[model samples]
Target: MIIDRIDRALDMTSAIVAGIDGGQYADASLCAGWTVRDELNHLVGGMRIFTARLTGTDPGGEHHDDWLGDEPANAFHLAAEADRAAWRRPDALEGVIELGFGAVPAPAAAAIHHTEVLVHGIDLALVTGQEKLVDDQECERLLGEMRAMDFSMFRNPGMFGPETAVADDAPGHRRLLAFLGRAV
Candidate 1:
């Protein structure tokens, strides 16, 4: 059910992307430093990285920051555009393999991909003045992961003092983003 909501959200996001008007792609976004196109691309590119890793073809994880070589925003925009197109490919749905991450199977990569698509789609919509809605289930799953993950992973260090306490019962999606310092 959660995955279904995510998949639906991704599909809606793709539709929104397809309708973007001329040069609207270059407009600035709420991401502070990134544009809508850049955010979409970044969102999709991050998924591809997970795809590669789950396939065991990502290389012993030795490359700590594979995306380090490219502009983070551009990396996402360019990669996401390609990936968005790739999702249209017939083989896209056939992907499934396990590189292992605790109980998370390779298909969990699909979940992660869905999460990025939906959550970042909201970001894109917010910046582009588009309509974006997240299903309750999808929000729950994302909020769960956001809580489980340190979230500081996306932020600069020392931003949250060790004494800070995140209330578990806080609204899930907001909790996730806020913990990452993006909810504000």
Candidate 2:
């Protein structure tokens, strides 16, 4: 079930990445200090690391060096497909994996990947003037994940910025963004 969610999120992420053009890549993304291209690179790098984790291999080093290859969209597609393939392995969903923070069950790892892809997909859509690309179901799922997580887990620096203040009755997506320290 979580793997299904991860696949859905990856589909959305790939679509968003494919829609970006060269000129728009320089636009500021929702991620602080990151341009649209930088966010996409981060997504690619994350996919590589997660793929290695699922396959029981050391991720070794940052892949940012070649992040923006001749064709970024193609690179994203290949990376995402590899990541998906790794997760689809027979024993992939049956083990614990180190997520840098600690070792977590495979399902939890899938959930984390699902959240990252969905959140960053929205970021990519927003910056590319494709707000219509945002999926309400994906937003709702991520909002639920945020609601179910412990607040303390997000308090540390580099985990999230300080939680932003939002109206009590804000929509789930807006609230989720606020909770992640993003100004919506």
Candidate 3:
């Protein structure tokens, strides 16, 4: 189910975050103008925001706030734990979630959260030489889901870019990244 997918994504992302070297945090990531630290901070913030929305609590900060103050991995772990718990709540997926953009059905929000966690995990893995940690099955699954949806609305400079071309024989992760406009 969706919660299981979210859990797997969160676990993978937490592993990637745990393996990041201190010095590599400043390195550039596939996301334009975002360093590894920036991407991680955003991921952590997203987790916190989603959790807050799910539990009806204040997130206490903005999306771009400095979430990775001293120990980035610890921050990610804490947020991921909270996010996982929130998603697992008995009635978590029974209603609409109010987001910054608008209200989204709970299932849709879970899928979006799963995609964000997995994709950002891949982004960190690729840049930090931890590609082996990526789950190809998850990528393929999300890619298929995205293909069936109207993803064009999210195709923009700050979100997903125009789909980039990739060899048909590329690995699932690479193909998924290419589909999301990452130069994989």
Candidate 4:
């Protein structure tokens, strides 16, 4: 089930990138200072980091802030494929991996990446004026995962934003965005 979720997430990310035109890459994303391209970079780099951990290899980099500049589509597909391949390994879904922040069990790591891909996919869609690209089902599933996890570590500066108020009756996606500090 988790692997299927990851596959779906990657497919969504790939489709978003494929649909984006060249000129929109510089638009500001929901992430404070990051552009759409920067968000893509972070997504790809994150997958790279996860792949490294799962494969027990060095990432050969101190940071993952670089962007594709003019080649985002191809770069993203290649990186995404590598990431998916690594995670598809028979043993990749078991045991624990060090995530720089700490050691997390594979399931928790999958959940983290699943949330990242879906949320950032929304960010990319919103910034590009392609909000229809956001998947409602993914958002709902992510909302459930977020609500079930302890939010203690999510309040940090670069992580989740301060909790925003949402109406009790708001839609699942809106509530999820609110919880993540994105005004909805």
Best by TM-score: 3
Tens digits of per-residue lDDT, candidate 1, 42-143, equal 655565655454433453233233542434444444545555554444444454644233334434556656766776666665555664443445566666
Q: Candidate 4 versus the native: TM-score?
A: 0.89
lDDT of each: 0.53, 0.80, 0.93, 0.80
lDDT of 4: 0.80
Q: How would you encode candidate 2's per-residue C-alpha lDDT over 21-112 as one tens digit per residue?
A: 88987889888888888888888888888888878676556856556677778878988998989988888888797776889998878878
Which parts of model 4 are misplaced by more than 4 Å? Answer: 65-69, 156-158, 165-171
- Residue-wise C-alpha lDDT for candidate 3, range 80-112, written one tens digit per residue: 999999999999998899877899999999988
* Candidate 4, position 112, lDDT: 86
Q: Give RMSD to native, each candidate.
A: 7.4, 2.2, 1.2, 2.0
* Candidate 4 residue lDDT tens string, 1-184: 8878888888877888888889988888788888888888888788878888888887655446663545889878887898889878999779998886889999889888888877887778767776676677878888887789887578864588877898988766667788899876
Candidate 4: give its CA RMSD in angstroms.
2.0
In Å, residue 107's CA in model 2 sits off its true spot by 1.7
**Model 1 CA lDDT for position 14:** 62
The model with the greatest lDDT is 3
What is residue 70's positional error in candidate 1, in angstroms?
19
